[model samples]
Target: MFAPRVALASLSGESDAEWAKACARPAGAAFLGGVAVDGPTREAARELVDRDREEFLPEDPVAFVDDQLAALDDEFLRAGVNVRATGLEPLREAAAVCAAHDAILEVNAHCRQDEMCAVGAGESLLRDADRLCEQVAAAADEGAPVSVKVRAEVDGVHLPTLAKAVERAGADAVHVDAMDSRRVVRDVAEATDLFVVANNGVRGREDVFEYLAYGADAVSVGRPSRDPGRVRPVYAAVKEWFL
Candidate 1:
């Protein structure tokens, strides 16, 4: 059997048609951006981050949040914010969108962008285990497999507890942001049984393979495919080498 390769599609600019096209490829799964929940226009939302070249979140981060929520309410109705939204409606919508597209849906609690965290999204969820579990369970009930993406935290010991909570909440997988630290990857892998995916700094097929060997059941690459020309070769390599 071929090892599965999941693609993280840039849902920011693409339409549902574009998303469906990407998902239709031989890739085993697709992950959409969670940041789209902020802005009305993808360009406007990204500007929030781009404007802050110094801190990666400019002097005013709400610019990003404004963009994110605008995008969510207008373009990506399925996008869900980690904290801004009070109820599960947005999450349910996100799950529905993934199901309609025949793709696996993921909750992004891993983004460490200062603006993102300050707003209580992304890594902020790590501090609220109970709420995270509730979100996970609600997402799972949407009838599609759900995965929660997270960053390894201080002491790293809390990962196992968090992973267990995720598993108990019915997440099909736990995507850990592996930031070029083999020790961190190893520690995380040893801690969880839920299908773990290692991401961050994964540049090529070899990196993907290394993650698998280290205990990841899957892996994700970001932005390498934004240029349509670069997408095929990477996809081909993944199919030829990993799958």
Candidate 2:
């Protein structure tokens, strides 16, 4: 049901439009700009920058998303914006821009930074299913495709249950960071019909096949995405698996 079998995952500050454009060839899709929207998120992002952790703290989150997605080549079947916001207004506004550009507005519920959690964003949303689903619903209400970026091994989190909740909240997909627990990708795929994008340590066809064999509809690469040469093998793996 999806066009892209492989995607490039978003990297803080680094996964901007230029980065996406540079790495556009190997992958079928890309997630760009984890933009920090709203006062609390932007402030927290600035704090992260102080610690040498780069973040996209744009003055206008909505426009930033627009310009970034607009810069991507149409060779990508899907383009997405990974956004961080503690409020519905900025989130909705950013989603509208995604809708306008036919890009997916991805809710960033996966970031586990202490600063992000302190502001009730990132993995904090994962812990609070109600809040996370609410953000999904809000973004979906904007008439744009919605995906929730999430991670594994969080305290008290069950991937199957969480995936079901996200599906019910009007999400089209779940971008899962299978951190150390790759089998959670299987659990989540079996639990919900949401398009599952398995991420983390996807170095070769072996890793891609592992996720695919576990029932993932797609796979993504994060840090490795910076090198198109590194991404080429993963792209070949996806094409082979899908065939």
Residue 44 C-alpha lDDT in model 1? 37
Q: Model 2 over residues 1-243: C-alpha lDDT tens digits?
A: 245588889999999877776667777778887888889999889999999998887677777888777776364546888999899999999999899888888999988999988999999998899999999999999999999999999989987899999899999999999999999999999999999999999999999999999999999989999888998899899989888
On TM-score, the candidate that comes out on top is: 2
After superposition of all CA atoms, the RMSD between model 2 and the true structure is: 1.2
Name the TM-score of candidate 2. 0.97
Name model 1 segments beyond 4 Å from true.
Answer: 1-3, 9-26, 35-86, 153-157, 228-243
After the best TM-score superposition of candidate 2, give how far the Cα of residue 237 lies from its true spot, in angstroms.
0.8
